[model samples]
Target chain A: MSGYFKRKEKWHKKYLQKDATLPMEIKVEEVSPQMSVIIPQGEIDMGSSGELRDVLHKTTKNKVQTIIVSLEDAGHIDSSGIATLIEALKKVEAYSGELRVVINTKKIFNVFKIANLDMVFKIYESTQDAKNA
Target chain B: MQKTLNESVYIQLSSNPKMATFLRNNVHKSCSMVGFDEEQTDMIVLAVDEAFTNIIRHGYKMDFTQRIDIRLKIHENKYFKIILQDNAPIIDKNCIKARCLDEIRPGGLGVHFLYTIMDYVEYTTINERNALIMTKHLPKKSRTKRLSSVNQQLLQTLLDIGRYVHQILDLDTLLNVIVNEVKNLIQCESVSVLLEDRETKELFFHTVLDENKEVANKLRGLRFDSNKGFAGKAFASGEPLLVRDVEHNPEHYNKIDEDTGAKTSSLLYSPLKVQKRVIGLLGVKNKISGSFSEQDVEAVTAIASTVALSIDNAYAHETLQQTIPDLSETNRIRKEIESARLMHQATLPQALPSIPQLDISAVCQPATEVGGDYYDFIRLNENNHAFAVGDVSGHGLEAGMMVSMARSCLYTQVNFSNSISDVMTAMNRMVCGSIDKNLMMTFLFAVFNTQTKVMAFANAGHPYPCYYQAKSDTWQLIKDGEFPLGIHEEFQYSTHRIQFDKGDFVVLYSDGILEASDENKEHYGLERLLKLLGSKKWMNAQEIQLAMLRDVRNFCESLFHDDLTILVIHFL
Candidate 1:
């Protein structure tokens, strides 16, 4: 019963306040019984990097088999946000699980290209493509 | 016609946009009375209206109460002159520029139209007022009609050069543009600018331009004494020289032609002056069509004065750019010193320990951002309290770090041993083995017992602690100690015991107090400190400490060059 309410609260926060000046918003959806998808929107800067780090920490602690991060509406991501993503990816790889990223905007994708993180992460063009992989 | 030529009209009005239309209507009527056609009258009216708008908007910032005086005069049936005067902030003529026509901007066309229609337009500030003088030559019906376009071209060239000078700030780029523009305008074979070195009083060719690039390269950077050559003579005398035949001139420096392999037939040299002081020389050599004329000399003189003022501005900008980095480096070092000071302050004891039958007060003040002086009070057990004061050899970050290390080692040693001599021996070994070889610290440690009124003290090359007996009213200094820590680890330290009664106390200090100097370079020596402490022996521990610190401050006039630390303990 607690898991059902936690899922409901996550969906409620994702739809409301779409035009607010929040750093980010996260939505969790169970793709299968063993895997889940985390979609984040808006800019991921220094102010919101800590929230992303905590979500990744809790997901890996529960020993999920695969995690997918969809950044379809993310407009900008700075160096601190990129560093948090890299740390989370390393933690998932240490256990036998996998982590994938889905980026749609050129501005968000170019940040990874500039830092040469495009070669390290398993990236997909869309969330649909990531789910199939 | 003679009555019209000598007529003068003066209009005084406030700076308002509505007044511009009235002013233009009067100018149109005046031009028509002098037999100007409809198109010519319209152009003159437009130019006059724009000038008034500029004086009101830019000069006065649209303040309508300022007065503007417009004077119109027709001279000798040949020229029409207009002078507009206003009291406003002086405009920097160098920075006034017309926009590029290729960019397709809407504004900045007023100055361009004035330069195109008028034969001469000059702006000057005299006695805190701006005067803009404009003159247009009246068109004639003969050969002078053919020369009108040529005069127009000459004015256009000078305006173009003036605009270019204000655009480029790089010295090399500016010199290249000036030399090329002057050569084309005067139709001379070559043009060169020579700059005067303030230190040596010599002139050197800064930029040279000729039809042949090889000859120009050879003449660049050539130097001569300012009183020797024709160019030098023009600079030294602060006058312009037009030499038609160089062979007959005694001031011609023939060595330049000998080196560059170029012939010099005619030369015109003008001194470049700014505010009555000559800065350099501008020379035009060997006209292509004819010899240098009086008109050529006049034109080159006007160009020289404008170039001199522009060069001064470029030098000032370069100097300011060079000093920015030096200012930032000083700011960086100041912030680092502030950080080190905060770190040193965090290592000090927050509050003094309050034990039974003892009153204690300790204070440390650093002269700079960070200092090497330190003191601490620790509770060894329920019956004993340990106190220490130390002075490191130097100041700043390294000294502050050493003081912190000494503090941690002292606390660790006191927890394990109750004997003062044993604690000093262990602290000396730790400092000698771990710290830098050049660093040294002088420390004095003592443990006081509240039940027996017994104090065991060990001194290590520090200033002696002062012992005062209230019953006898005498002061005694304890100076018997071993070497300072970090110097010799194997040396044996001796512990001395003293019994204290009620109203007896001891004062421990660093060398900063004894070495503080007054304006006369007199040290506040031990004799003065002993006398002050003896007089205040009957006071409480905190009162005696404050009195001693105040005395030292008063003697030195509050000028402290070293870190001062003092600790006072009283037995009740």
Candidate 2:
């Protein structure tokens, strides 16, 4: 009778907690010598974690070893996003690659410390700087 | 309401030590009505006498012709609001910081007494009127456990967290201080830090929370090496892991929990990062009995970041002073102040909402590292827009962060589809969970629907903002709201709604506007605000903001000690 998921008496999926669309997307392109990357924004939680993982995995299809995960635009994150990064790092390391972070706003910088992932990543001051590095 | 509400009586006492008795009686009577006890009565009297003595000796220099206005009519809840409207010995609200009780002496204790005893204080000079409004209510002694305000619990938690560390600003101390604050704030059974070793490429135990035990026991010498368990993952990935049901979670490590005899059920951890580089893992394990909320994560993150930045800033300043060898203490304090300022800026206004029908501008000018005043704009929905401005009962960083807590509650409520009244109620209820019972805040919140031209608002013991008429060019004061948050939930905020035709301006301000003082010790009162609005010198929000600030600056020669917040809204 409904378009989305409907529940039976035995199985109750709290309707209020249903998954929704994400506001962040990891868009990478091997466009010419000049590069532009669109990293995730908002909370990098489990909801957007898979999409990010898949995007990062696919973005490496081209043998571009130097990639950037620009986080200056990102406001928050959970462990799932960190996991996705770890997975991406494994793939990048397989080809001797380098993943850099762009922190436009230092607000996101401390978030890395709170998550304990600051040591695991190579972060730069800005996207342009990350690209240069 | 037009001719009566703005009425205030000023009485200046020059060299009247005995007037302190009368001051005590009058204030005590007003305070008793607002619920002060005999002890509180004595404290208020002492504070007033010291103030009166200081004024008589220093301010007027025995200038009897210059009167200090003592207006005692108790409205806004039978609370005694002592308005020392004087042209002598003006008190600077900026100097109101928490002095170490160890520095307790008699000579300069007037401000300290006023701060420690009274609940609220504001100093301002409008059109040459030096006015100080000191507001306070006696703490409910009989019903300690029965009542709680969110602000009280939050401040209490901060204070508790602060208790573990001798001083909050002392970062060169050790990780023991950080762990102690975390343990106190989280009410955790135990706290341990896991830091990544650069040379060894391994994680080792750094500190522990044996706060009540002893200093030597603080670090416990515990180590959980690489890939051992949750702490290791936390160390490896540099992320906080909360094992709510630690016994059930596959990744939880119970060694530390077993060692402490702490049943590992819930946890909250934050990573210590410096410029996006994780230094280590700091966590509170086994939260008393419940699961931690997202707010817990955010709060831990905030505290951790503040610690990291302070440590880094101190380290840099120390290095600069040594290597460059020309840096001054002022430069060091300035850097400290700047980083503190950055922390405030980073926490505020991530994005100014581009609401479809709203053009909003808001600003926060703190007198110091943190101020007691705050005003925020939060959109509840498409049509229902909410904004709140408030001042905590005291001054300083503690009070400022409490204001942040109130703001966060409002934001969380706004995010969860909460209405204005619901938001206020939730905020009040939530304050009791973390703040101390001693602190309270005066707040004003409102919602407006542009299409219907209806504005709904609630005021929690805050100064009334003036609602303006573009056609008549007259200001109408909306002075009907309830007590400040953390006072009592039994007091409900009365939501008043009115439909505007169009082009009406609404001006909201802190008590600082009515109380800004000049060198002559004269204050800028509400009549002046009405005059400014009436003269048509300032038409819209921008003009009014600039003009009012200009007038206050001219009145006091523009040097402000207490914070000033002025918000204006116009309906098109």
Candidate 3:
């Protein structure tokens, strides 16, 4: 990795741990203009939502049109996380951009229905669909 | 109107049609005996037949094992009151609502009918007996105005049969849903509901003849062999049963026929189970002496399912009230453990920030609900160190509680005392006085004079500390304490003084640390721990502490049991 990438990785790792041990962290890569994916690799409760929101804000602010919030390694999601995703979706909608999600069914479907927002989105079966779109 | 007059009546019936007519006439006689009109007479008759049929078919099953007890009275307000009591089983309401009876065929028609006919329906199980309390108004002026054609017919039934789907729950309100719906749906003289027992396995008439209530005494809690009565058999087999005549059908329980003194021409029975467990039975008798339609079953079943669920719900609500205290106690205990864990964590320094020039680190873990170990480091003179480590007797909350007490007592006087032995003596004495005969604390305290490189310490009943010398490359366990903390009134604590140079490490740990276990239940023995300590090349206290923890963690792979605490201090 380049010095900038290494520094960012170290920053990401350093800011993530509790006490001094960084909790399992997600990998975020600003690989291209139209793509930015956040892959959480550990439990994602309300504690994780703040960091997720920050990452989404940074990506969208950079004019990333298609954002993939991937949970390939993420363990869980609380009410706040689902709410943050909805808010982030709304943000993307304002820009006429696409926001894609890759998560377990139980984690997202229940929240979507409980909040009555299941019908508002163009949901795909997998994250690959969002990336391809 | 309020009625509290104590009048109790108990009756048993035979299913002969003559007895059924007698019951019909007697109900009017009973109503007029209290000066009630035909409208009131109809309510009593309808409710009585409903109750009697439920008991005979569902409760007694053609055998006279239990009796029906009816408590009736004309209160001071001239209102007719009745409480039908039985000893059947009780069903939980939540479990009842959990079922889907809206399917093409339902298993709950009788309960729906009962709910439709009575002005008020109540089922209560006290001790072992079950009771049904149904009430109705005698005055026509009390009836609702602007009734629909279906409700008008049902109202007329109330005059002769007591009540139907429209005012079924109490014969006073709106079963408009079941009434209007059933008019276009099923055929019957009146619908009734029998409450089922989930625990004891008996069914009883909870809502009878739409308004008047009859309860079974010996009838409650009667068990069935799955295929006993038309209703009991249906409940056991998980199937719907249709009988054209109670007299002709061998499956029909004649006790209902014999008890009511009326031979029911036809009977239909099904189980009102919620969440797979049978809660009660729902059945319709003498279906207008005609061939019962699938839609008739469908419509009655629809109403029955909802009514069964309602009865189940009411039953559960009563039970939940009884069990709330137990549930809350469990929740309260759980919350206490959670808060105690937080308090224990808050007591520890979040970061144990680095102390300049001197290497220092500490840890505290326990074996159970709470921990008893404690270690505190207070800065003395710029070149001097003040520290104390204590282990309270026993384990869990009691010991943990004493740990806090010792900490508080030491903290209050350390600011005023400079002598480590004096502080230790004071602490020992305080703990001895505060704790009862069963509780106590063993403590070790020391003050290190950096300039002189001298360490002065006092020990109570606790174990010795082990020191590692870099010069000799050897480890020595030092025993410098007396017996445990609370035994004597003025227990004399011993003091020791030693001079130390750079690169020497002192390790203090609760016994739990050396005795920690892995998944295989093997302990991280003291010998292995000593060997691990002997192998570490690091002289810094931080490095030694971290290495020790790493070794312990490695030994306790997937199953780390017990609390392990270790503290290491090194002279720089």
Candidate 4:
């Protein structure tokens, strides 16, 4: 049983190392005059969460009224990534703007649910639903 | 290159960029004549070029008309010495600060390169002229046996620094002292310490000490990827790096210099390792007189090891300080739990009522300080007696409180209702009305009639009571029950009837007994329990109860994960 736990821990460390090696890409697109969409295309972990936070802060600083974060291409996000999103939400709210998230991955969505943040933030099934909101 | 042992060469040159090559060649030839190896000769030539460049660019401020006098001497057939005297304005030794190596740039490495190649460096003012003297010891035939006075001094300095570092516990003070002492000990232009963030694998400049405050501040808070720069390389490889020329070194990262406008020339970097794991990097850059030598590397590496240990101690002290309040709070909570456990123990039945031809025994052990499992016996009259065993959903103060509440309610309702089913229904209604919706409990209530030799019981989601017949060596389980109490207000339960014969016994238990798991997660299931009880049917009620508990204790091996309660009644 101890051996099993040791093997499990080793696999977990390897998985985290693999996740850290993947390059993080963020794309910003202007959907309308008031709305902009930011899509992150990799794991949003400690190594890359700073980039997302910076991009979000910049987008809100530009006075965009509505910001949508699309996690369609994001396979995994840790607590640091969640904290960055929370910071972005607070930043947009201070400017009387709004922030919405669109997530389709069940695993990522379950994280939000478990933290009870799914109730706190506006979540949508697709980009169309978020844009409509 | 064939020169006499006492030969001395004196030259005067204008402070110009073109003079550096001529000076380098002259120094190379002088060193070759002294029997220096190729590598040693190249290092000597580089140090000479760097010194001339500094005199021309920084000391003279690029004034080509200024004349600098250089003297090369072979001293006592064992030391090669160079003396450079400049007629320029007297240089303030205090004002000469080496730029941070972390601030990788193009210009500041001159003085550092000079200290790397020479054994002794000094600047002095004599007759109103600024003179810089540098010396290199000749390589002896028996190198290993010659422990020079310089090595002894270095060792004493390292010991002093180690003692000083160990005496301090504050992280900031300790780091500041380390960087300053290292710069002074190694005679380097600047010293900077970079500590690793264990989680991110990033190195951040913790302290940058230089004579120039502006240069030092510029490199403060500078961060580098652990796999990027020379310092990072040292940390990654857990080794010391001696870079004689930073400009030609491939591992040098120049981004910091570009941002801060500071320069770096030579670098001596050592990894701060604890338990063979790299935790930080310590770098000394730009020796004031000559490039860094093997002795400088050895001294700085020793200091780096001490710095690692001191940092570890400081961190441990900080964590202990932070946890002091938390530890006190934990102690207070533990005391409160202990009191609650004692109160719950007080509520247990102190002595069982003795009746003719009946044996009754019960035992309950909580998994924590306070338990949710409760057992009570109420005497209704001379011929009637009521008994109950209940398990709340959770353990702790709230569950223990619920157990007391159930005991009070059962004591009052069992006397009013003659049937076990009516008493259970009433207790369920009271619990559903008073308790939180999320909380519920499993309960069993039974009443024995002394004259009729019969037992009537009602179970609400509790484990069924087991019956043993000594005449046939048979076992029977009574499992007919309703949903657990406090879950539904209108749920109905039917009374279970069993006629007791002589030498027959009934065992009432909570789920804790059957669900006790071992380290391998295998539970003590019902089959093992039934077999144990069947074999012990011939024993008295108290003995049978002890025998079953002992079996459970042996099987689980002190790995009880829940409350275990057992009530055994024998009829004669």
Candidate 5:
């Protein structure tokens, strides 16, 4: 199956309210003591990348063995968004932990590929796949 | 009439992060109105959002109180133009380049997105304000619709009228040319204009052109209350009105017809307005063929606007001609200041003096206005050399005079004084006697004895110099200072001594370095300066100074607000 098949549009509709005032919605789920999954829904550009960075920083500080940044519901991602993931990878490496990202579409995945970050982080098609890895 | 390729939407918002959402919403709606597809609209909105955020972040330096003006219009009927203007300090356009993508920096992507998505992107400074203009080509369907038959002619005619606005200056001549053009275009019997007398609050016949010279002669110099006639109703309401049958219209006043004794079956009335102020009334009477149509009203309203602006400009020109004598004196003073600035820069040493044991390099960059930052090297004797860097408190000719006064006194006093403290004390007395107490200068003076490998330095309320230790590979600040010069005459100054090792260095700079701030309003702090200095220990004196200057320039893309002076001395 194509990676686009795992898009979380309905999932975003179920969890996130249509709020124009808020830049984006970030939800963190602790699957276990050693792992945490952070789902960010909305366009991640300079305006909202700071929020994602803060969440990633906090999750890494907790000493989680593995952290997954799932952009399955994200509509778009810009350079700042990619930079935030790179920063998280750096912090995770300092503690000898694992950092993974879940991108559902080739369009957004190409953004990471263009930045040459796809080779740096372990990417998956779904949150379940990221967790399994 | 303002001739434009397409209608424009203007928006002004406070420079705040939260306002980005509001800006995006408006941009989406405007894109839709211009018939952009979903994907294209999203891309345009993304580009516009990045631009707005960049303005709030970089242009205004996160200053929430400042304002940003945005104008969205169609250019040449085929491209959508976005003009964003801000009142912040002028940006250095050369620094607006997108960083190399390999760098992976967080802040440089906004400019990249702007260039990638928009067809044409330009950064400019207009009227001392920074403007970012971007344009994207419209889709095919919208382009054809914009080039319809009727609006094309209207656009051409308006363009011609716009040319008149810039070409003609004499009020009577401009009015005559516009009136004749309006009469020919509308095919009307006569076109008349009534200007408002601001002092009397009345309207008088400013321009009356008609085929019947008798009627035109009678209408001249006719004055009436601004709210008494058909023209007054349109002028007061600031709306264009077309009365098809003026004989039956209740709002129509027959005063003009009675005065000129001309039959008026129909007429179009438009308020002549400029910059949102109703300046006069434009009347096109007796449409020669049939009654006036809605299209005629629109055409008359457009011409009236252009006419009003031309008249206002002519009036301003008349006033400006009366004030031409006063402007020449202002220009003369400006020239004198420029020459003084050149002379001020000439006083500083053009070349560094060579010493056997020391490598020294110094630079002084004045602000846009003439400033009082100076540095000098005086070889007192063969073995002993004296160096000094100082900045007066303010800018302009007064500060320049203070610098020269301090320099002359220093050269004379350093030769006669016995110690560094004695030199400072004598300079302090001279400053106290020469300048005002409010204006003081921060100065640093040092003397190096090449044979003993020791230096004596004193600070007069100046910033502490950064010192690098070659052995420990650590940096420290040589700190201790009393009042600045011109503050106290009898104050006893103290001198400090430091021993230099081979490969040791000291960097002296003005406060402009420490206080230079980035777009985030974060200063190029002392810690960063010390870290940078410590990292570049392998570089020579000139290279280190260039690196420090380049770092500060990168930190603050705009010009430095104050004078910047840096002097580096390396022991080898």
Candidate 6:
């Protein structure tokens, strides 16, 4: 059973494609030396989640004290998209940095809720709301 | 279960990232057209997106110019099916497993979403294209129209064959797959792919398949000119030809049927072209049913392109693998020969012996390759001096080492004994004992007594030395034919005596001088050497030596193929 799971893991790694960039538009805005905001538009699924991860990884590596991800314009978010946020959240917490996400759509929020990561991350109504908090 | 209206739509898109939005819109419209709500449509659209992105990222490796085809079909307003196809190497579909979503990772989620949203998802390959077929169980709705499904089994068959061809890199296996697929598709009695030898341009039977095993076995070894048969006509014209009756056709070449003992009733020949150049011919013989048709010609022509591309790729791969090793081996041998050349140069006579009665001059010019040629002058006592000119057979490191070994043995043996025969016998025994029979040495050993004016010399398969007596004004070659050194161990070597007078000359040389060939392949033989020496007899030893070398150079304009060494002695 362990060997079967290992093979299953290999299959996932093979089929789950990753690229240097994604198709959607992603904007990174700097608030200060230790704070930043990432705005991703359109669908954040398998095809575009890689770009989201790239932005989040850069912000975490820069040792930002507070990183805000705004998903107001995103129409859809799949499991891979949710996993990208979870991965970034883990990196930010490791350095005692704060990661806050602002969701305006119920569909994209439901994806995070379905993955049970709504409680794992700091969710707000908007980027301004999260920055004020 | 009642069947209702069947609707199908086909869409083609380039493998570009921006095309994702266009594809999503079409898939979403496709779901609603089948009477699905917005929420369920989004789930179905996302699944199709994931599958398409996987094809672009992994299958095409993100080449945006490649084409992708999608077929959306709704069956009875219940079963919605999507088939996506792309021309890529066939990957094993069985190994595709959705990740266990328990592990929170950035990847492995696209496949999970695919498996969760779709009712039944499957992966397959057709031709050289990877295909993903996903089916979703639609919510039941009221509809009462009956329709028939489109027949595309032929397309599937071509896809299967395309997959087989591109997946195999080995030329032999690819040719076999081609023959088997052609035979199965056309239902022919025999199939063969005769590839032209790129250098010879002769068509040889690379793969042959026949129901009659004996005929197939005979045809496997058969080859002929590519311009002789109906197949040749197709190859020459770069077109497909279908002959319904072989006996009635004037272009039919019956040599293959006669040689293989198989009757030729009909033949269909298609030229396999890659990049507009015909590489080979694909021929099918005697259709199993009635006769060949235009449809059969079209089918064969279609697959020939795929076959030609695969064969060319395989040939390129095989040539690359072969060339790398050959280059490295040549480099290795070249370095060894260079080192051997340095070793050969060190073992030559550094300075000629200086005596009051004799003027000795010697020159040993090495060739490009390491040639095992050596000459030495050793003073035995106050009045007598021993000298030798020898050549080891063959070239490179082995021959170089043999010359070095013989030099050491000659030096040791000449010191112990003054007899020319004793030094010759000892040198022969040492060569025979140390190395194998393939390598041997031709040596001429001579001891000159300056006081008595007598030259005693013995030959071991070496060319006889040229002797010019000033008194007789005539040249005589000291002739003796004996086995070269490293042959017979106990063979007795006899010494020949020559009385020298004032102004006498004797030339000791290796066979390279006598056998040197010009551009016309004519050897600079003994007659040329004698004439040259007679003309330069008035000059001193060194002058005559240079004159002889110049004459040989004039005879052969190119570089000498072997090592040339000459030792000259003039009685002063």
TM-score of chain B of each: 0.43, 0.43, 0.41, 0.43, 0.47, 0.42
Candidate 4, residues B160-238, lDDT tens digits: the string is 3443333332345457656755775788888998877656777888788876657787888787787888877787789
Highest TM-score: give the candidate number: 5
Residue pairs clashing in model 1 are none
Candidate 1 error regions (>4 Å): A1-133, B1-327
Cα lDDT of candidate 2 equals 0.57
lDDT of each model, Cα atoms only?
0.70, 0.57, 0.54, 0.71, 0.75, 0.72
Give the distance in Å from residue B508's predicted Cα in candidate 5 to where it truly belongs: 0.4
Candidate 5's residue-wise lDDT over B303-408, tens digit each? Answer: 7766765554444333333333434675556556755665566667755788988988676767646778888999989999999989888889988888888899
TM per model? 0.36, 0.36, 0.38, 0.35, 0.39, 0.35
Q: After superposition, how far is residue B438 of candidate 2 from its true place, in Å?
A: 1.8
Worst 10 residues of 6 chain B by lDDT: B145-154
DockQ of each candidate, alpha-carbon based: 0.00, 0.01, 0.01, 0.01, 0.05, 0.11
* True-structure RMSD, every candidate: 38.5, 29.6, 33.9, 34.8, 27.8, 29.9
Ranking by lDDT: 5, 6, 4, 1, 2, 3
lDDT of 6: 0.72
TM-score of chain A of each: 0.81, 0.70, 0.71, 0.81, 0.84, 0.81
Q: After superposition, how far is residue B129 of candidate 5 from its true place, in Å?
A: 2.7
lDDT, residue A64, candidate 3: 81
Q: Judging by DockQ, tell me the better candidate of 2 and 5.
A: 5
